[model samples]
Target: MTTNLTQHFLLDPEVVFLNHGSFGACPRPVFEDYQRWQLKLERQPVEFLDSRRGLAANLRVARTALAAELGTDADSLAQVTNATTGLNIALQSLPLKPGDEILTTNHEYSALEKTLLFIARRTGAKIVTVEIALPLNSAEAFHDAVLAGFTDRTRLLFLSHITSPTALLFPIERLVAEARQRGIWSVIDGAHTPGHIPLDLDALGADFYSGNCHKWLMSPKGSAFLHVRPEWQAMIDPLVISHGWTADNKEPGVRGPFGASAFVDEVEMQGTRDPSPWLAVPSALAFRRDHDWWQVAAECSRLAQETAARVRDLFGLPALSAPSLSAPQMVAMPIPPCDPIAVHDALLRDYGIEIPVFEWQGHHIARLSCQGYNTREQMDLLVKALGELLGLEQPRRKLGQA
Candidate 1:
């Protein structure tokens, strides 16, 4: 935390970036590693792609690093382009009968919700949505909302590990356990989870989970992974059928260090494309270790908590979650009722700050992400800009002036 780590990243110096959750900003060294891999591929397309050894080794190394960091078996996980791609693959492979219900919370990422809808349309599956009340205080509040939507027809539970809109980390471990007791499949969207918080995919025990390395792990874009529990791996197919379709499905130890399961081989054996982003995950893990990540995470957490409290008070809006239940590095704080699009544009153009402003479930909110590169000065600038746009005095300065 002592180092001014902004020098390592490749962000626009003129703009204050507060939206790390959307698309992560990669560091110079990691970006260089990515470019190096891409250039190597271009130089000898046949040598890189045809040999299969290099790509296979890179995939093993990346998955090994991720497995160590995320607490799951390496073979059970396979790299994908992004979380959305992974979700589509999983949803498509499911055996949904007519009128079977796929239950999910309202706070999920919109695109994935649309994916579920696509699946519903293709099959005769029905979608059941649970409305979780805001100003949630504990894990019990989350548990209640989810169970309220369950019925005899509920066959699968799709929920976010960390929701995109509300930014609250759901208490999924117990829910997954309860679903297992009743023979239900749990599909989790964990796009925001990798480096935002500690991950233990095995312990969570969801039947399916998809997470993005590009968002929080500081990897290149187009890097993510889908993890299927061993029981479900055989049934899940590749999004695109390539050479792997003919490959042996039950061969044990066919691949290298991480090796090929029918799952890993089928999903990863697609034809030629740039694999630099997935390959660069090892470098991203190394970068995280070289810097003191614990301290960096702590600093970001403190800043996030302070920003959330101040913003919520400014608008007289309630906290969407308890501090521990909310993410340490990101918070979806409610702003006073105003045109969020206007405020968003003015902040970027007039104040040179980059962040996200969106409407979620009929409320306008701003989600802020504090990274190692950010400082209190940048936060103060954001607070000032928001105050002027909202036509109010500085919220932090006028704490007790009621």
Candidate 2:
């Protein structure tokens, strides 16, 4: 059933689209809904943008629905273009002093690493990274690995809920608790968590968390949210100074610390932009809900597990991070010694397979993702392609079919 779901997506029919981890493909219905909001905006620009109450109400509805799913309140959230922007706001907003260290993992997204580096260089703070061992067995090992890097200079602990390069789900809950006990700010880059996995943001209890709706949530591009805890919300500054910026914290008395009105006024009241994608969040949620997304994601996760096993067996390489419990729907495996760019070119040129193959930690890593639209046959083809490229006979591993 999930394999048949390809008809709903606008992906190229000829290519085996396995790189859902990169830029996610939006389903037709959700894309239509995104366009509908854009059309509505175009119909009456002034009236739509000036209607503060109407816009706020629309955002409230969308955030309320999303918050219910994410296990957080609408008051704690603000819309952003993507997780990168949200993280930029968070990293820039915090009032860090010189010599304050922001600790993170080596598995972080490269873009985020650059952002943090810039912040550190600008503010005299330091970016400290800890290494996570491959073939990870348990969450405890991950937590221990990060905790081992903790020191007195570490003011904040930054990490991904689901890492980008390696595709491992960290033990964030325990890490957050550990950070809290040590008076460290816990910031999570949750760009891949919302729709792929079950998220309980309130229970997770991180000081700050940002994620992309455009990725796992299957929303149109440019839809994401930044969630700040009560204590940290007042400190958050908008990346751009606009109408929302004022001498006074507007409506601070009525709107608690980070309630929807205050948070929106501070972070969301930026000058001008198409707010359509964020408004279309409900449509994206509905698209998945109508399709029994939980079961679909579960089915895809099984295929992802099988794909990882197949790739590892084909390459004679160990899994990068996933071992006991496989990454849900996305996995990164190490390939044999080869030029990553050449392999990337060959995969796209010879094979009509769209996947990410890159260098990480001096190893050529290829991350494979299986969405609801992906099929087992496509995964088999990927295995065959890898075997032929690497000059090995494809060994049929005793893998359980998803």
Candidate 3:
């Protein structure tokens, strides 16, 4: 049964929102928590803003909770604005030289690709993008495609935990292990992984991993975390430098407390900013516990699987990934020979459904995401709308006219 609590989100009431995989929807309770922190900061700028120690303490609490969730030490995890920012910290901090190659898959997010290109231009390094064939059938095929990218010049392996456009979950564990065995650095872009799927960073064994708390954890925007292994901590220099660099009381050249230096020292103090989103992470976790989000996930997964199956039956296209390999909460269904943009626009303008549709190397995919708020009636409506838009009812219409 769907809970009434799911109705508290701020998404448009008229539209069927299936794009929670993009920017997440925050519940009323978590939003209130975020506002409270903002109010506290506003009440006393001097006490809250001036005191680095106080802000750091609050940040410490949030980081501790996030670290516990990801299965890593608190010191190794730093609270960033989002997964992309954390990813930038890892990619930019790398001490790459000319001729070094950062290997990645062709299914990477466009923003991250631009970041890699920027790094390549600056350091004279090469970006190696290996293609993983679509309708990805097995883990062995993915592993082989990634391993084939490894070469003597390969210095780093950057891959997504869950690809953005394709909406397929990659088998990162095998790739991480292979990179470690070959003495190459592994950086995982886990923007969509944390809340959508189970995460055990320590067991996953990636050298650097970054994820968004806002997406799956139901936190407010700007809530994200970056996890770094102890050995690779020294390589990262924070994107911002403030009082963390030098002080009258502290010793010179001292990093902050988290890593070799403080995690906040390198990253946290980015001039005047709001820390409310980061501070409200714990409250988001509390909301999940209070509402039993695990059960919600299971229900959502069932709906996603059922919707995907119906779409597949209607289209007669092959399933992208097996049930066992992919999470039931999200599914990518192949669209038949049609203009992806045209079909996507028609769905939105005609049906009033909000879902993601895109092309991946000559194949069109209509990716649907099911959350607790979604209803079976909504899925039925979507199926009917898609069928009508795809001309699947052409014969029936002709018979009726006759």
* Number of clashes recorded per candidate: 0, 0, 5
Ranking by TM-score: 1, 2, 3
- TM-score per candidate, chains pooled: 0.94, 0.93, 0.92
Candidate 1, 145: how far from true, in Å? 1.6
Tens digits of lDDT, candidate 3, 138-176: 989989988998999999999998888877888889889
lDDT of 1: 0.85
Instruction: Score candidate 3 by TM-score against the native.
Output: 0.92
Candidate 1's residue-wise lDDT over 1-402, tens digit each? 344589999999999999999998898899999999999999988778753547677777888888888899888888999999998888899999998999998888999989999999999999999988887788998898898888999999999999899889888889999888889999999999999888899998999999999988999999999998887876787789885554444443345222467688778878878889988998998999999776798888898889888887767888888997887899998887766776787789888999999888787888999999998888889887777777565532333222
Winner by TM-score between candidate 2 and candidate 1 = 1
Give the Cα lDDT of each candidate.
Answer: 0.85, 0.83, 0.82
User: What TM-score does candidate 1 reach?
Assistant: 0.94
Residue range 65-138, candidate 2, lDDT tens digits: 89988999887888999999998999898878898999998989999999999999889998889988777878
Q: Which stretches of candidate 3 lie over 4 Å from their true place?
A: 1-4, 246-261, 393-402
lDDT of 2 at 77: 81
